[model samples]
Target: MESPATTKDTASRTQRPEGRPGYGQLLRTDGAWSFLLPGFLARQPYAMLTISIVLLVEHTTGSFGLAGAVSATAGIAMALLAPQSGKLADRFGQGAVLVPQVFLHALTIAALITVASTDAPLWSLFVAAVPAGATAPQISPMVRARWAARLQGSPLMTTAAAFESVTDEFTFVVGPVLATALCTGVHPAAGLIAEAAVSLVGGLIFAAQRRTQPASARAGDAPESARSDQARPQSALAVPGARVLVVAVLGIGMVFGGMQVSLTAFTESIGRPGINGLMYGAFAAGNMLAAVAVGAIRWKRGPQTRLLAGYPALVVAAALVAGTAQLDPWVLVLGALGTLTGLCIAPCMITSFTLIETLVPAGARTEAFTWLTGAIALGQATGSTVAGQLADRSGAGAGFLAPFAGTALALVVVLIFRKALHTPHSGLVAARGVGHRTTVTVD
Candidate 1:
């Protein structure tokens, strides 16, 4: 019973406006591109270098057990110290904290290489790992916070996150191969040295950017506020949505960690050790492709819905991977597809972070985000330890199922608690007028 004119008006209002830039448009922005370049340069090679060093150490020692233990120790150290580092960044600016840390990190890496290449006792190797891990700069979180601060409420923030996720995928996809080639092609020691040098250069370059430097200290503020003002933002964790998101991401991290070892086992069991890298590369490729695709689309639904959907999909993907392991003939093909199904990863992460930004107050932003990072590290460490043990015992097939089961359990818990944990928009909206509130949006 609607008039033709009225119907047309409604349709016009609901339809997406023409000439509106999509994800590509956002990426094309000066600020977006400006941020992207340095971030990519700093992170890409860093990932490759780190992974290569780990693999080299394991190969040289001829002990997976030692490698796993060392990696886990590092992971735990990072998790424990991340919050403190993040808090420092929020108070004194990331650049201030980053510069010194990067130098220390570089030195630690060099020392590790020297000690590792020698016939140092296992205790010496373990002792060196503690300092190396402690000195590791929290670069990823700082970069993320910088982008959030610079870009604010624009869709560009999401785009930036998508870009970061793509970088992560690329790093994982290419890093292992690059690392292996470097170690074998050159020397294992050379790889560690290269990684340390690159990290130092990258960190210094990022710090040198005048625009990206930390804010100058304000005059006449209370001791507490003054301290908090200099630090990275911490307001987000106080919000219910951001809190739940952090928890969920931790679950995802655990699943990823467990899968890492399981994938290695599965590849070896199938008598195709070389294909192990290929399978992992394929998985990362799938995630990259999906992230690009998601960015290309215009979604009417909220990020929360997207995240909820992605979690279950991961569960299904894990199951598919497990099922394929039983069908030896089709394992490779199914493995690829199963990996593709996990394409939702980047988009989900992007959405969750964007939502966190929207919900958290400016004062607490950095700390909240760092907490998410720490949770991920913790989950990964836990997952890796448990999964490695399982694989060592019952066979690789059972290892593959670990992630599936863990993801399923986590998803169920989140869904059951969703209503209680759902963050209201009122607090975020109310804070907009305050100095600490940067942006507020409701969907």
Candidate 2:
């Protein structure tokens, strides 16, 4: 099913020079820029959602606990539903799933903003959040799948994974800062309003880049062998070690969720609310820097070892951040600690994604990616909810504990499942062949 032109393109790029491909060379892939451009915009709304929700609902109800709870509801909904979205994208194509989903997402976000602004019942906020989160575009995972399609057999796959993580970090840098500035400077509702607009416009543009989208699985494309051997395509969760990775990512999400809410509360308590964005941007900048460094390295070891080595460092960083929040609530100390925390994050995330490429079948690549992302959302929701309550009762310092606890639990999970991370190379090759050439969409 590979086109002659596409085949030739891949063939030309497979031979590596002296070192690994640079980020510049990775972007030179034939159709990379088309999807990457729109994908950057499409992913921003996701980064904005947590901070935007926290600020808006807090303004509406005048309670951080309620704000965190409402944001958690949205995060939990997205986490539960994202895998299904990935499945639909896999089956029906990204455009088919993304176009309608974006419209619904925009509508839901508008309804949420209106409800919050009008001081609707607390229940109404939760109701609006479900569909809003559920319909949020799975652009990050979808874009990663496209990279796999283009660079599956090439060494650039590793670079692509690292670059995507860096891109994700960069959006976090921009999105929260932008949301905070809008909410504090312009209007409380401005951040959510901006999130809705970007999701609508950006999602449509990304969905329109059909040529770069990965192929969807079709009934006809199911090989006779696959049909006779199985009743349905295997779930990505069935892949060995995928669940462990999800648990690990959920822990990281907790750090994010806890940090955002706690940082906001901390700034407010200190009577300098506007500085929250700058501090969060500092955290994200560290993550972006680490991601770049991780990608640039040519590792002889596998992703599993990197994950094992990097995660404990994250736990230590999270603990240090918490200690700093409790002992010295100054902006400068917290900001420095936050950057250290961010530096620990990208390596684990980049390695987890790399493992997905090694472990999951081509048919379930997007779904597997979503599982990790959704875990993050779910974890973030949990962290926010817990930290919000803690901050309300004790102080911002108490909220900082959420991330430390989350990271500790995640380290335990990773250490326990350490052995399962390995898979036979032959099995991976066999699994990847299931539907390699099935095109999901076309220009």
Candidate 3:
């Protein structure tokens, strides 16, 4: 007969082999690809179509003021509701939250088309905008959380993130062109219809996946390890470093929003309204290039270091934009400068996202990601509002310079708080030891 101590040791050795798969193994499995494909397809076209219609409405109405207001309203509503939506995902599973939200969003888009076609009052348009904004599904966060659950700690997480960034770039590039084509070539309503169809189909497909479904609501039926994994840091807002990441991304969004208005206004002021597309395209192209480059370059540097390093590039880009106020150069030259200046965007966003992924607990991932999205929306709204007012008061030249100044200010603030924001205890290190260790330390 075996001694009790020997038997206990033997059981421990036997059980160790049954441990959960690491991030690498998860990515290599079929499930990761299945989850990723649906998310990418669903998001890319929706983003493209939505932006196109928003711009088309502004162009058609001949009121940047109304456009700005509508955009701001939608943005503010989305920002406010996004966190709650994330919580809903946590409570009711991503599929349940996402599928219904996508359907509602589709209906909202259809309604907006009707409202735009009629001679509706501005207030009516604003009122319709509320539902449109509020129902904007928390697609990115939900998809990310699903990916985290499936892939855990593998390179798939990085790859999936890079894929998302690339898709965003593709959307910016393709969405505007498609929107413009629809608005100018076909009817503006066609663009709205197309967006609705994409949302409905994509949303439904994503929601149908078995892996994406919520866990069964039975006592003790929950995946014990997964539940405990994310339970600790669900309230990420209280974390100092996470707060800084949100603030930094918000400022970045504001800069981009202002830049959009300023760039258009400047193009029009310089007798090149037709070239607005070219300038914007160039900027997006730069960002795309940077994203691809960064994705290819494997870096061991912490997210903060990457973020801090990228800031000066943005500062230079902003300075260049400010200088464009007086440049009597060819349109192509100006476009090139704008494109080169935009190189920092992808790197900055990627770093911020990676930091959030590393810092926030698994269960709180959706909420934390939603906060980042909300920050971007809020920033864009602020920037657009400020730029529009400045453009009306001064020339578009002055408006174009505004984002540069804002970006410079943001850079300074981020640099000042770099040490606090980049501290080791505040980042991905916190998430690494959850199951393996007894005590998890969060800063």
TM-scores across all candidates?
A: 0.77, 0.88, 0.80
Q: What is the C-alpha lDDT of each candidate?
A: 0.61, 0.83, 0.65
Q: Write candidate 1's Cα lDDT for 1-443 as tens digits.
A: 54566445433432322343244554544354554566666665534543444455666785444555565566777788878887677666767877898899888877777778889888777677777767776666667766655543443444456566656667666755555456656776665666667668877777666474435343223245546565554456557766677777776666656666666566657776556556666776776677556656556555556667777887787777766665663556856764665574665555556566656666766666677777766666666556666666666666666666666777887687665344455432111111112233445
Worst 10 residues of 1 by lDDT: 428-437
Instruction: Look at candidate 2 and give me any clashing residue pairs.
Output: 215-439, 215-440, 216-440
TM-score of 3: 0.80
Writing each residue's lDDT as its tens digit, candidate 2 over 1-443 gives 65677556675654443344656778778788899999999999999998899999988887888899999999999889888888788778899999999899889998999999895778999999888888888788899889877775565775676677778889999999999999999999999899989998999999999887777766356345444534556688997689889989999999899989999989988989999999989988998898777765545456677789999999999999888888856789899999999999988887787777678776566567778888889999999998899889988788899999999998998899887777545332110111111112111
lDDT of 2 at 346: 87
TM-score of 2: 0.88
- Pairs of residues at least 3 apart in sequence or in different chains that clash in candidate 3: 23-154
Comparing 1 and 2 by TM-score, which wins?
Answer: 2
| Residue range with the least summed lDDT across 10 consecutive positions in model 2 | 430-439
Clashes of each: 14, 3, 1
- Candidate with best TM-score: 2
